[model samples]
Target: MDERDHASLPEGTHELSSEVSERVRSVISAAEAAANAVRHEAEQSAQVRGRIAEEEAIRIVDEAKGEADAYLAERRRRISELSDTVVERAEKIVARLDRAEEVRRQLQGLADSLGESAEELAAQLRDQPPPSVPQAAEAAPPVEQAAVAEPEAPEAPPGEEPPTGESEPPGGPEVVQLAEAPAEAGPAEAQAGDDRHEADEQLSARLVALQMAVAGGNRGDVEVHLRETFGIEDPVAILDDVFGPGTDAEKRVAWPRTGDSAA
Candidate 1:
């Protein structure tokens, strides 16, 4: 080999240093291996941390969704309960109002009936004639004739003579003569009847005043009041007596004869 070639030759080759080169190579390889191991461990740790974070996030979301669903369900239940309570209370109020109206109508009808009764009583008192005294002699004839018609007692059978002051037969009904009442009333009795008549007239006048007040200004209302007061069953008959047929008052007070007219 030429000197120049020898000079260009690598120094380590000229020194024949295989062991040194091997040692240097081993040191470099060790450093590269350690660096690679560190990199691999760091990547694994990062992957594990990312997985844990993702699982935690998913679990948190699931818990939040469950809480939201429960809250919503409770809210809906409360709303339903409140709505039912309000509706129930409103129904009770409406029912009470209806009952009150019905009672008012019934009271009005009762007042109308009482007024009618008073009017009828007034009309009867106005129409009735004063009572007259009965004649005494004319009332006594029938009573006197009845006492004289008894037959004579039949003679006791042949063997039996009638015992003096004998009692009537056993089991036979005893005859009793009732004494007739005097035909003529005393002055005191006649005066008492007059007083009763006067009191009746006063009562009738008071009833008439009550009827007028209840009936107000309406003629039909007054007639209705009168019929109810006197227990008059027939509206037409009361109307006929108070106001003759074909009169306006009669037409107003008379009951309809048929369903068609009533309608």
Candidate 2:
């Protein structure tokens, strides 16, 4: 069982073992190559999947952004339109108010003219003469009593007719002389005439003003500055002041109040 047993082993056993070992090594190399190829394919597939997912995410985000931008743009447009509408309406209202203010100023000017005319008329009347007889009689009551006592006058010479008077005494001065001789008589008469002429002129002027107002026609708002500045609230009353209350000019002008103005 020593050297002879070893020498007695088959002669091809070593060669067979070497051939089997080479075949196993070749199989292992092929298997390793197949596994590497599969790994490389798996890595490529994972990379491709990642790239596709990134592209899809980018597309979705871009679409969402586009929709949001469109929505924002539409909202901005609507807001702009609303703002324009509001501005237009406000401008129109402002224009109307300006026109009303102008009208009010004009009406107030007319009222001032009327007030001036009234003042002038009042001054002229105040300057006119009062009766002279009533003042003299108070101081000359004795003369009045004498005139009453001597109702019958003594006859003058045949050539001269006696001056007979109803209210005067025989010794008293003539009433006509006292009437004309007063210092204020001349100025009072002149003032009365002047006042009458001025009143006529004022009437004519007021008529003209009323005609102009009627011709122009009242605006819708019909505000008068007199209402604010002078506290004359009624449009009709303003017209009355301008045209003279209850006069033909006032009736012809027919100035309307707020409700009638709208009509």
TM-score winner: 2
Q: What is the TM-score of each candidate against the true structure?
A: 0.36, 0.40
What local lDDT score does residue 177 receive in model 2, on the 0 to 100 scale?
48
Clashes of each: 6, 0
Worst 10 residues of 2 by lDDT: 217-226
Residue 20 of model 2: what lDDT? Answer: 96
User: For candidate 2, what is the lDDT?
Assistant: 0.60
Q: Candidate 1: lDDT of 243?
A: 45
Expressed as tens digits, the lDDT of each residue in 59-173 for candidate 2 is: 9999999999999999999999999999998788676666666776677577666656754654554565543332433445555665577656567889986675664553456
Return the lDDT, model 2, position 176: 35
**What is the Cα root-mean-square deviation between model 1 and the actual structure?**
17.6
CA RMSD, predictions in order? 17.6, 14.6
Model 1 Cα lDDT, one tens digit per residue, 174-228: 2222222444454456678778766664455344434353334334554565566
